[model samples]
Target: MADIVDTAVSAGSFTSLVAAVQAAGLVDTLKGPGPFTVFAPTDDAFAKLPAGTVEALFNDIPQLTKILTYHVVSGKVMAADVVKLTSAKTVEGSEVKIDASNGVKINDATVTAADVVADNGVIHVIDSVLLPA
Candidate 1:
């Protein structure tokens, strides 16, 4: 199996996300071992941001890294595991609330697709970019 980066690239829906990850210098980290659970936002999700939001973040590496890392948790949390949790700590050092009452939400983003397996971790596609509070 391919790594998270490769899997996302192959999926073709994460073009913006992959670009942001590259810009944030997180390609290596996400491809590394130890099982990360990434709530990956799609290109459409990035588009949901304000007009200048994506452009602004692209130039701010530190803040960009924070936002990208906020989407990641340090475990291979699948859909079943995620549904059982109320919250999970992110790699960015903040906790994201998980609400399974409707479908499944991480912070304010809805989980659109789940259990996308990767060699090093798992990816759950989300519908919005999760901004840290």
Candidate 2:
């Protein structure tokens, strides 16, 4: 099995996300040994951002990294586990609200796909880009 980075690349729907990860210089970290749970946003999600938002983020590595890391949790928390949580602290150092009462939502994004297992972690595809406050 491939790592989180490779798994995302193969998914083919996260082109913008993959590029942002690379641009933010977090490729190695995602590829490293981790029990990470990534709330991955698809290219469509990134596209939903305002014009030039992505481009501007690419030039700001620190901001990009924070935004990217906000999608990750330290442990491999799968779908079942995620539903049980009201909140989870992200690697970015902020807590994301989780709501399972009505489907599963991570912050404002809905979970479109869940439990995409990777060698180093799990990936849960979300419909919107989650930004840290």
Best prediction by lDDT? 2
How many angstroms is residue 67 displaced in model 1 relative to the true structure, after the best TM-score fit? 0.1
Per-model TM against the reference: 0.98, 0.99
Model 1, residue 5: displacement in angstroms? 0.3
lDDT of each: 0.95, 0.96
RMSD of each: 0.6, 0.5
Residue-level lDDT of model 1, residues 21-74, one tens digit each, is 999999999888859999999999999999999999999999999999999999
Single out the weakest 10-residue window by summed lDDT for candidate 2. Answer: 17-26
Q: In model 2, which residue pairs have backbone atoms overlapping below 3 Å?
A: none
Worst 10 residues of 1 by lDDT: 25-34
